[model samples]
Target: MHLVTGGAGFIGSHLVDALVESGQKVRVLDNFSSGREEFLSHHEDSGRVEIFRADLLDMNAVKKSMQGVEMVHHLAANPDIRLGTEVTDTDLKQGTLATYNVLEAMRMEGVSRISFSSSSAIYGEAEQMPTPETYGPVMPISLYGASKLGSEALITAWAGTFGAEAWIHRFANIV
Candidate 1:
């Protein structure tokens, strides 16, 4: 079974649909914050999808979702960049901490594969347009961006430390 965090949200929901269409058993862990149930309502009738409403900050909850999971698609985060500035702890709890919990859960579950949805925010205002993957001196201007960059680091470090494999996809904007 495959696990998707924020699986009720815009991107996650679409991903869940595709996974289920391919006959994959999917487990979705979502707290809804920005994820609307309407986006995933289409999957309620399918036996392939199981939705678990829980915060990733809760390690036990994250662990529960990892059971029998072979791969993880982690997409949960503070979606509002402006709000992240207004509420300083949003990124730490929702983005960074939540990601940490997921990684630990994966470690305990012996799940070795993870895919993360990192954003282009890590670049801040780039000096070089068309930022390459090897772009260095990453300076994120917002708390949300910092959290994303931190999460990326955590994933790679976890991979190096624990022999886990990871795929980090950096997207620009989600419209």
Candidate 2:
């Protein structure tokens, strides 16, 4: 079975659709803070998808949801950079701590692979227009970016020590 952390959000909901179509068993963990119930409502009747309405901050809940899952797709995060200024700890709790919970849960469950949704914000005010993965010394300008970078570091360490694998994708604004 596959686990999608933010499986009720825009990107996550779409990913669920594709996974279901491909005949894969999917389980989702979301707090509905930014995600919507309607996104998964259509699949409610389907037995292939299981929904767990919980926050990533809850370690026990996260661990419970990760049970029997093989691969994980972690997308739960506060994407709004503006909110970071007002709620200083929001980025840390949602982005960093939440990711930590997921990683720990996966480790305990003996799951191996993970695909993380990083961001171009980690690069901050880079001189390079089209930044590549090999970009030097990532300097994040906002708390959100810092949280993502922190999560990346944690994942890297986990992969090296636990013999796990991950694919980190840093997305740039298309428009």
Candidate 3:
């Protein structure tokens, strides 16, 4: 089974669709803060998809969701950059800290694979228009970006220390 953290959101819902179409079982964990149930309503009757309405901040819930999951597609985070600026710690709690809880839960559950949705914002002011993943001097401009970078660091550390496999994708505008 696959676990998609933000599976009710735009991108996540689509991913769930693809997974279901491929005959894979999926478990979605979302808080509905920026997601809507209607997005995933199509899979309601499909027994292949299970929705877990919860937040990543809840450690016990996160660990429970990890049970029997083979891979984790972590996409939950603060959706609004403006909100992050207005509420200073929104990104910290929702992004970085939440990712930590997910990783910890995975560790406790003995799940070793994760695919993280990162952001190109990690490369703050770059000289190159299309920054490569190997870009140097990552300087984030917003709290959201900082949280993503921190999450990336945590994921990296977790992979190295626990021998887990991680795939971090830094996305820009997803039009």
lDDT of 1 by residue, 1-175 (tens): 9999999988999999999999999999999988999988888888889999999999999999999999999999988999987889999999999999999999999999999999999999988879998897899999999999999999999999999999999999889
Question: Model-by-model lDDT, in order?
Answer: 0.94, 0.92, 0.94
State the lDDT of candidate 2 residue by residue for 1-175, as single tens digits.
9999999998899999999999999999999998999999999889999999999999999999988998999989996888999999999999999999999999999998999988899999998878888997899999999999999999999899999999888877523
Residue 79 of model 2: what lDDT?
69
Give residue 90's error in model 2 in angstroms. 0.4
Off by over 4 Å in 1: none
Error (Å) of candidate 3 at residue 175 is 2.6
Query: Where does candidate 2 clash, by residue pair?
Result: none
Tell me the spans in candidate 2 whose CA falls farther than 4 Å from its real position.
Answer: none
lDDT of 2 at 101: 93
Instruction: Pull out the clashing pairs in model 3.
Output: none
Among all windows of 10 consecutive residues in model 2, the one with the lowest summed lDDT is: 166-175
Sorted on lDDT, best first, the list reads: 3, 1, 2
Task: Rank the models by TM-score, top first.
Answer: 3, 1, 2
Score every model by TM-score: 0.98, 0.96, 0.98
